[model samples]
Target: MTELRNPVIRGFAPDPSLVRVGDLYYLANSSFEWFPTIPIHRSRDLAHWEYAGHVEGAAPGGSLAGVPDSGGIWAPSLSWDGERFWVVYSIVRSVGTPYFDADTYVSTAPDVSGPWSPPRRVPSHGFDPALHHEEGRLWLLNLQNDHRPGGRRFAGIVATELDRETLTPVGTTHLLLQHDRLVEGPKLLKRNGWYVLVLAEGGTGFEHGVRVARSRNLTGPYELDERPLMTARDDPEWPLQKAGHAELVETPEGEWFLSHLAARPLKTPEGPRCPLGRETAIQAVTWDAEGWPRLRQGNARPTITVEVPDAEPPAFWGAGNCARSPHPPAPDNAPPYYTLRSPAAPSWTDPTSRPGRLRLRGHHGPDSLWSHHLLARRITEHHTEAQVTLQANPTTFTQSAGLLLWYNTAAYYALDLTWAEPEGEAQHGQQWQHTGRTVLALTTRDENETRRAAVQEVDADTPLTLGVTVHRAEAQFWYLTDGTRTPVGPALDFTRLSDDHGTRLRFTGAMAAIHAVDLVDASFTADFTDFRVICTSV
Candidate 1:
C-alpha cells in the first residue's frame, strides 16, 4: 500500500468540496476575500493533490473590494452532473453581525480548469451552500441563519430545487434537519436507497466535528446517526484538531474517502495557536454494519499518515508532501505566478512588459481595499521561506517596492527597498538630488500600529535580494549583505495574523506578496522575479 500523509492539501485550504470525475478527483475550497476565488485542486490517488485552477470570474466586476476578512467567497460546493461541473458559493459581506449579509452565486464549467461561466446570483439563505445532483434533478443545500436576538446562528439545514438550465429556485425552500448542537456545510448523497446527509457540527474550532444523518426521502426529517462520523474535538492532544467541514467521495476502485478541514495547533503558553490556518485533510472511510460511515479501524481521530492502494501515486501532486514521502519527486505545484483582485491593471502589472520578470506599478499600497498593486500567493506552510529579487531604484521615500507578508490591511510585515535620506535632510521631491542611499528596510504592522527598521543600506544600482523564514508563529527577516545573507529585525509574531487575533474576524491566513507604491508620483516602477516559497518542516 502507498502510505499517504494527512493534510493532502495543506495551509489555509478550508471547507473542501470533493468530487470524482472519471478517473480524476477535483476538489474546491473556500477562498475568502482573496481574488481568484474558489481554488480547485485535482488528484488521482486522493493523497497527492495538485493545483488545477480556480473559479476566476466568481466575483462581480472582478473585485471583492471592501469585503471584510473571511467575508468574500465561503464554502464553495463543487459537483458534477454528467456533462459539466457546477459550483455554488456565498459572498459574505457582514460577519459577526446578526445578519449574514450575504449573496449566493452559481457557476459552471465544461472542465475543472475554467472557461467557467460568469457567476449568477441566487438566494442567500445563509452561508456554506452546496449543490447536489440526483437522478437528473438539481438541488441546492444551505444552512439557514437566524440573526434575531436569542436565535441560534446556525438555525438549521435547508434545501430547495434549482433549475438545471437557469440555476434559479424552483419552489420554496424546505427545512431538512435541525440540531441543538451546531450543524452546517451539508453535503447530500444517495446510497442503498437512502438519502445521506453529512454535516459540519459544533463550530470550526477545537470543538469542531463531523455528524451524519440519513433519511429515506429527499426533503424530510433526517435521523441523526448514533455516533459521529469523525472528530478530534474531544482529544486535546490530537495532532489534527478542528476536524470538521467535510465532504465524501468515491474512488474508481469503489473505495470511499472523506475530505475535511483540520488544523495543526501549536501548544503555546497562551493556548493552542493555529498559525497555519485551517488545512485540507483526508481520511479513509468505510460503511459500518448499519450503513453509517466510520473512519479507518482502530483510529478514533485523524492521523498524520494513511495507506492507499499500492499503485502509482496521484497524477496531480502539489509541492509533493516531502515532509514524509518515500517516493519519486513530483513536479512542484507551487502556485503558478500570483492572483490579483482587479484584472491585471495593464499600467500597473504585466508579465509581458519585461521578459522573466513580473513588473508592477506602485499605486495604492497594501492597505487599500479598493486599488492595491499587490501580487501574492497563499502561504501554504507555516515553516516556509519566501524570497524575491527586486530591480527598482526608488528615488523618493514615497516610492517603495519589496516583499510583503500580508494578512489583511492591518497585520503584515515587509522588507522594502526604498530611498532613505539622513533624517531631517530627507525631502520628498528633493530625494532625487539628495545623497539619500537605498536601504533594505523592515516594517511590521499589528492592528493599527506600525513599526519600521532600516536593516541595511545598499547601492541603488545593484539588485537587492530579500527573504523571510517563517517557523510556525514567528518570522525572521533576512537580506543579502555583502556576499552572505544576514538576519535583520526581531522575530515578528506570525500568530497575530490569525482569525482569532485581530479586533475583527480574520478568516484567511498569511500570504507572501510583492507590492510597489508611488504615493507621491506614480513615476517609479519595480520589476520582481524569481519569487518562490519553499515549504519545510523545522
Candidate 2:
C-alpha cells in the first residue's frame, strides 16, 4: 500500500476545485489579490501534485489592482467539456459588505497553461461559482450571497442553465436548495440513479465540514445527509484542521477521492494562527449501500495518510493533454515564483537581464495593493531560511530594495539595501544632501508599528548578502559583513505575520519576497542572484 500525505498541495492554496481528464488530474484554487490568478495544478496519483500553470488573463483587465486584501479572485471553478477547458470565477472588489461588488467571468483554453480566451462577464449571483456539464447542456452552480444589512449571507445554492455556445445563462435561475445551516461550495455529480450534490457546510473556520444532498432532478427539493462526509473541525488538536470546500473525482481504475482545503495552525500566546494558510488535501472516499459518498462508514474525519491504487505511468502522462508535466517527481512547471497585484511584469522582474540574475525594478512599496513591484513565494514551513545576494546602490533614501517576509500591508518585515546619511550629517530632500553611505537595514512591521536596525557605511560596490532564518515561531534577520555573520534586527515574533493575528480575515500565507521601491522616482534597479530558500523543519 502506498501512503499519501494529507495536504497534496501546500501553502496558501484554498477552495480547491478538482477535475480529472483522461489519466491526468487538474486542480484550481482561489488567488485573491495576488497575481497569476487561478493557479492550476497537475497530478496523476491523487496524493502528489505540482503547479501546472495559471489561467492567463483570468482577470479581464490584466490587473487586479486596487482590490483589497482577500478580495480579488475568489474560488475559481476549473472544468472541462469533451473538447476545450472551461474556467469560471468571481472577481471580488469588496469583502463582508452589503454590496459584495463581485463580478463573475468565464474563460476557455485549448490547454491548461493557456492562450486562454478573454474572460466574458456572467451574471454575478455570488462567489464560489462552478460550472456543471451534462448530456448536451451546461449549468452554473453558485452560492447566493445576500449582502443586505440583515440577511442570511449564505442564502442557499442556485443553478442556471447556460447556452453551450456562448456560455451564458439561457433562462431563469433556479434556487436548488435553501438550508438553515451555513452551506456553500456546491459541486454536482450523477451516480447510479441519484444526482449527488456535495457542499461545504459551516463557516471556513474550526467549524468547517463537508456535507452532501441528493435529488433525482437537477433542480428540485434536495435532502441533506444526516452525517458529514469529511471534516477535522471537531478535532482541534488534529494535524489537519478546518477541512472543507471539497470537490470529488473518480479515477479511471474505479477509485474515489475528495479534494478539499485544510490548514495547519500554530499555537501562539494570543491564539492559534495558521501561518502557512489553507492548503489542498485529498481524502479517499467510499460509497455506501444508500448511494451517499463518504470518506468513512461511521464517522467522517480527514486522515493524515491514505493508501492509493498503484498504477504504471501512461504515454500521455506528461504529454499533449497534460500540457507541461513537472507533475510531482519534477519541480512544478510553474516555477517556484509569483508576483502580487498584477502578473509578474517583464519590465519589473527581468530574469533574463543578466545570466542567472533577477533584476527587480521598484514601483510601489509593500503597502500598495495595486502595483507592487514584488516577486515572492509562499512560506510553507515554520522553520525555514530565505536569503538573497543583492547588488544595488541606492542614491537616495526613497529608493530601496531587499528581502521581505510579508503577510499583508499591515503585517510584514523587510531587510533592504539603501543609502543613509552619516550621524550628524544633515540633508534636505535631494538637494543640499550630505554625502551618505550604503546601508543594509532590517525593518519589521507589526500592524502600524515599524522598527528598523541599520548597518550604514557598508561597501557600495561589492554585493551584499541578506538573510532571514526562522525556527519555531521566531525569525531573525542577518547580513554577511566582512566575512562575518552579523545579526541585524532583534528576533521577531513570526506568529505576528499570521492570518488570525491580522485585523481582517486573511486567506493567504506569509510569503518570502524580494522587491525594490523608489518612492522618489522609481528609477533605481536592483540585481539579485543566488536566491535560495530551504525548509529545515517541515
Candidate 3:
C-alpha cells in the first residue's frame, strides 16, 4: 500500500464526481464560466492523475457568452453505464438572489476523451444533478430549488425516473429528503440492500461538509447519519478547508474511496484567503457495522494523506505540493488551457497562425463577458512564476496585450504593452499621427477601483518578455531585456484576487492568463511564444 496525498488533483478543480470503469478511475469537476466545460481527469491508482479531456460541446450553442462568474457549469456528476459515460450539470445564470435561473443538461460519450453527443436539455429541479443506473433503469437526482421569496433555496432532494432511450421523464417526481440546514449535491449507491444517499451540507465555504443518509426504499424517507462523514469546520486551522461535495466509488477489490473538494488558504493579516480555489481530494472510506459510511481517518476532518493500493506513479511527478507544469512534459496529455465565456475558436484564437506561437485576435477587454479574448491556465500553487514573450504593435492605448494574474472581471493585475504619450506630453491620443511611444504598464483592479501601478517606456522594435512572480499574498511584475531583469511595478496585493476578498458572489480561482484587447475595431492581433509557468508550494 502507498499513501496518496489529500488533493490528488490540485488547483481550481471543485465539485468532484468520481467513477470507475474497469481498472481506471475517471473524475470530473465544475468549470463555472470558463470554457471547455467539465474537465475530465483519469488515474490508475487514485494517486497520480493526468488530464484526459473536457466534455466537448458541453456549453449550449458552443458558448457561455455573458455568463456571470461562477454561474456557468456547476457540480458536474460523472457516471458509467457499462457501455458509455453520462454527465449531468446545470448552467446557472443568476446568482446571489432568490431566483437561481438555471437549466440542466445531459450528455454521453463512449470514451472519456471523446466525440460526445450534443447536450440535451433534461428535467431540472436545481443544480448538482446526477444520473443513477440501477438494473438498466435511469433515475435523475437533483436539488429541488424553491425560487420564491421566503422560500428555502435548497428545498430538498428530488428524484425522477427517465426513459433510457430518449432521456424524458417517465414518472412523477419524488421528494427523497430534506433538512433544516442547506443540503445539495446528492450521490446515491446501494449497499447491503440499502440505498445510501450522500449530500453536501452548509455552503461551499469554510462551513462546508458531507452528510450521509440511508433508506431501504428507492425514493422514500432516509435516516440521516448522526455525524458528518467529512469536514474541517471543527478545526479552523486545518490545512484543508471547505471540505465537501463528495461522491464514492468502489474498486474491484471492494475497497471504497471518496472523492471530494477542499481548499487550502493562505493565512493573511486580515483573514484566510483561498486564491487557488477549491481543489479535488480523495479519502479512504470504510463502512461501519450499522452500514453507515465513515472516513477511515476516524474523524470529520480531511486527512492530508491516504493509503491506497500500490501502483506506478505518472511520469510528471515533482516536489512541493506535487506541483508540476500545467502543460506536462509528456506530449500525450492535453494542456489545461481555458478561455473566458467562449470556446477557443479559430475566429478569435489561433495556434496555427505561426509555428511555436499562439496568435490572439483582440476583441473586448477582460471585463466584457460577451467577447473576451483571454487565454489562461489555473494557478495551482501559491508560489508561482509565469512569463511570456509578446510580439504586438499597438498603435493606441486601446490596443494592448499582456500577461495577467486574474481572478474575475473585477479583480486582476496586468502588465500590458501598448502605445502611450511620451513623458511630459499630452496624455490624449492623436489618432492621425500616432505620436506616442511603446510602453509597458502595470495595472491592478479590484472591486473598489482600478489603479495604475507603474509604467516603463521600451523600444518597439524588440519583442518584450513580461513576467510575474507571486509569493503568497504579493505579486511583482518585471520585464527581461539584455539578459537582465528589471522590475516594472511595485509589489501589489495578490490576495485581492481571491474569493474571500470581494463582497459580491465569487467562486472561481486565480489564473495566469495572456490576453489582448482592441476596443477600437477588434482587429489588433498579438503573437505570444515561449509561454511558461512554474508553481511550487511555499
What are the lDDT figures for the candidates, one per model? 0.80, 0.80, 0.87
Task: Write candidate 3's Cα lDDT for 18-130 as tens digits.
Answer: 99998889999999999778888888899888767789899988888888777899999999999999999999998787777889999999997888999999988888999
**Residue 512 shift from truth in candidate 1, angstroms:** 1.8
Which pairs clash in the backbone of model 3? none
Which number leads on TM-score?
Answer: 3
Model 2 TM-score on a 0 to 1 scale:
0.93
- The sequence of per-residue lDDT tens digits that candidate 1 reaches over residues 342-454 is 54555433435565577888888767766778877666666888888888988778889999888878888989988888656635567657777778889888887887854
Off by over 4 Å in 1: 314-335, 343-352, 424-437, 453-455
TM-score list, all predictions: 0.91, 0.93, 0.95
* lDDT for predicted candidate 3 compared with the true structure: 0.87
Clashing residue pairs for model 1: 49-318
Candidate 2, position 407, lDDT? 88
Instruction: Provide the clashing-pair count of each candidate structure.
Output: 1, 0, 0
Top of the candidates by lDDT: 3
By lDDT: ranked, best first? 3, 2, 1
lDDT preference between candidates 2 and 3, better one: 3
